[model samples]
Target: MSVTAQTGQRDGTDRRAGADDGREAIARRLITGSVKRSYEPIVDLDWDSAPVPGRYFLPPGALSLVGTELWNQMTVEQRIELSRQEMANILSVGIWFENLLNRTLLARLMSADPAAAATHYALTEMGDECRHMVMFGRAIEWSGARPYRMVLADRIVMTLLPHVLRGSLLWVAALIGEEIFDALQREMLEDPELQPLISRLMQVHVAEEARHIGFARDGIMRRKPIRGRWETFVAGHGHALAGVMLRRLFTNPAMYRRAGLDGRATARSARANPHFQDAQVRGFASLAAFLEEAGLMSRVARYGWRRGGFLR
Candidate 1:
């Protein structure tokens, strides 16, 4: 018996050997269509663009300890470099998440019983993620910034981890990451300081991302029963990974260097900075509180919330 048959039979579905169901066929077509629709970014985004309104790009009350200190100390050229680094970091994070999402969707599609409707949904999701990566990558290049070097840990996770592990962890991670990104994008879209180019990009990206968040939540629910212990493990590890990723966002060494601060010192300061504490309180803390209220926090906490360095 084929792998699909082995799995499908247990689930009360008859499977044809080496042939996918009508639903899977439709799913593949939908995914291909969406991918084609999103393939125009290379020509769509103008690479020789000027800075959009400064106000729209910068979050309110968001400050890097090094960035703030460097503003007080750095020359104009230095500040520009720092700004580039910050943009690189943003682009890198976006690209990496997209890559992970695609990989996870592929894994889900491959592992799913051939008769399951979810398989088609997973394929469409994979197409969505692929488009996201291309969009973000083009955005970075258009902004005249180089891609950020993947952090060592991120490199390992992206390159060396097994697909099953990466897929599971990323699903949970997406839940948190997408939520924060949605909040940020919503704020940016409403800001008058945003340029037409960025506003348009965010508008498009946000609409697609909203659907992805729902898919992620549903995917997790569907898999949790069969993969509960595994999901829990990923969730625990996800907390630490989330913290590391968050720390990178708030205090990248390259960003500090560009902004005219001692990179190491700036990283240290940002990690211990009062601004971050406030951000945690108002941003992540609120998020955590909400998860707890929803009864999801205990499972997350069990996985590694305390170790992830966000709650404490």
Candidate 2:
């Protein structure tokens, strides 16, 4: 992966044969995957069943407080309550980002040919995202934790980015939001102690997002435009900055208070917690490597990746 490989991905310069597939092959594969293994979360999960007593909404290891002093100070019940709130918080973030993704996909479709395989798969993915939004909303409600509005930072980022994000940058943004969460959910799905409902929800989400991630990753490799220093700088830093925003999106200051902890102090502790940072970095490793291979990581953006706690 050299500079020329990155910038030369445009229409014609030079690429391994089949440069102009427009991702028809990737799209066709994704469409087949969707047909065989997609989920309708509403029908797949037993939404009416009562939650299992003493089961955790999130796996204990995934909790932000897991390795903190506060975790040791807390009782099992308190930790479970915190996990419940955290689960709701994560669902809320999922809803927020899925809305952005659906909107971006629809906007892109405005110019896409309806007959294209890529276009058909984009529609299929949007359908999955819609189901996911509804699923997350219901799951949040079931958590018994109140949903909160998006944070100021996220609101600002969404407002500013949608006007400019398209093609490779849009897909990169999608990957930033999807990959780690998908990884986290997969791990959660394997946890014997996780609440059954949450596990099922994760199962459905993980299955569908696999296709979405494939689509987005293909889009990035096909369209990563690194020709100009300025364009590369924006794409690199923008992707890194989206990762930073995602970290904040997963937390809500008010969730701590609702969970009976000191909101601000707990937030500070979680931000500085080595356990949480290491966990995120581990989940992010594969995606980072893909971006590095795709030539999306600019020098300064690599700096941002470290500072953003996504590459450490």
Candidate 3:
């Protein structure tokens, strides 16, 4: 073989070997954790009891629609109602991303080596996400809140998710979505004033998702050196786009309607609310650090993230 062809073959071998090594190690650990400790949402939660009415479903600061003028004007009951609606909306977003993630992992498995450790872990993750979706759906049903559907743009993007959310960049997208929800749930778990059912649900999710996030981080680190300049540029932009989608996923006008407010005006005010913007920045800070460390943060991506209001 010619020099270039020989080099290509070597690179491919290195990737396959690395896949079975580093990626598989992370996967094995995750699978062991899953097998040792996993809970069924149906049996784990006290579904017999309903959430207390007029109580916050989530803490006030964590609600995406808070920090707006409209929020300031709402009565205590309205605020609590909106909190439930907002938490439901967050769970709906989680379901959306979970669906996309499962698709990405399944597509990955089609080409993955059957004996590779990551393959088993990916299967484990898919099962976990299925349970999570059911749990989140139950939470929304319990709250009597409507599940937020993805906007048209987000739906359009889902068409390409199978292809886009793969390879080295796959874990980048995974971390962004996982970490955002993780931060929210972590806060809810620490606050005693939040509703008990919601707290217990979040507690379960946070426990399971910690393993998933570790797998994503390990995958990203394994693939870091494989990306070249052009690949890096594309990955950066892809991460930026994912960030934008995540921010949009957090707030919806329909949530305003559920809260008994004018949808358009309230959403518009939320868009302009500096407090909400700051929250987004803070929510994404650790994700930004990870991207920076992984060499996925480029100037172009930074611009997109800042312009999308996900980063300062």
Candidate 4:
């Protein structure tokens, strides 16, 4: 593919219409094919892989209380159900990102002058995501669980919408998604009860995600601002949409249902109950703090943690 700049635009004006757009398409196509390529978990991973000695997952002073409280609140059956769902969510993480990476490659391939550097990065990312899927899938299987049914929100964001937006949004969405995983993975790796296989999987994932987070930060920062009033309006709406999708994942109905609460009722309670307000509040606050600590709060426009109490 050609690497020369296209005609008609001034220096620094990104005239590559399809650089972001086409790259996403190319990425999705690649991911579809990659997913079809299979690997055997039992054959590849040692079932007896010894756990990494000492706490390797949780960050110091990280709020384990929240997760413990949330889990403890649920009945025994609820805990098992939620555990299954959580495991599925964990396994799906890499699979979903792999799909996004594939779409991005497609977009890059379609660009008028594709950046070799970007394509190379995408290839590495594709491999990382594949490894992540395998590791997570094996962890789930080892726990005697199958992947959870795709919820409506997941179907919409992870499944349906990647085709509609440009690849840039994928990176934007990814920045949020990966950061969440990075945070959680860090915590899980430290967990005493955590299986050795799961800890190793998280460790490997965190290593790869560090690069992805950097790429997403740069990609989101390089985008042009929305120009006109209508464009600004649309951009605002887009932010709202993105925020809603994110909040939905955090406040997943399956999460509540698995905890023995009615999924819808738990969602409603989360919205309405003051006693449980800390769940949303503290969650966003912790996330915001992480963003600020990582110097990302200013990068993605202010996350809506201050006024709304939650991301919704």
The candidate with the higher TM-score, 3 or 4, is: 3
lDDT per residue (tens digit) for residues 175-231 in model 2: 877998987787779798899999989888988888889888877776654235655
Q: Rank the candidates by lDDT, best first.
A: 3, 2, 1, 4
Compared with the true structure, model 4 gives a TM-score of 0.62
Q: On residues 167-278, what C-alpha lDDT tens digit does candidate 4 reach at each position?
A: 3445545665577567656655756655456665666667667666766655544443323444333333343344445444445566555545678766655544443345
Q: Rank the candidates by TM-score, best first.
A: 3, 2, 1, 4
Worst 10 residues of 2 by lDDT: 11-20
Candidate RMSDs in order: 6.4, 4.2, 2.4, 8.2
Number of the candidate with higher lDDT, 1 or 3: 3
Total clashing pairs in model 4: 23
Q: List the residue pairs that clash in candidate 2.
A: none
Q: Kindly report which residue stretches of model 2 are placed more than 4 angstroms away from their true locations once superposed.
A: 1-17, 224-231
Evaluated at residue 105, the lDDT of candidate 4 is: 52
Clashes of each: 3, 0, 0, 23
Residue 63 lDDT (model 4): 22
Model 3 clashing residue pairs (backbone): none
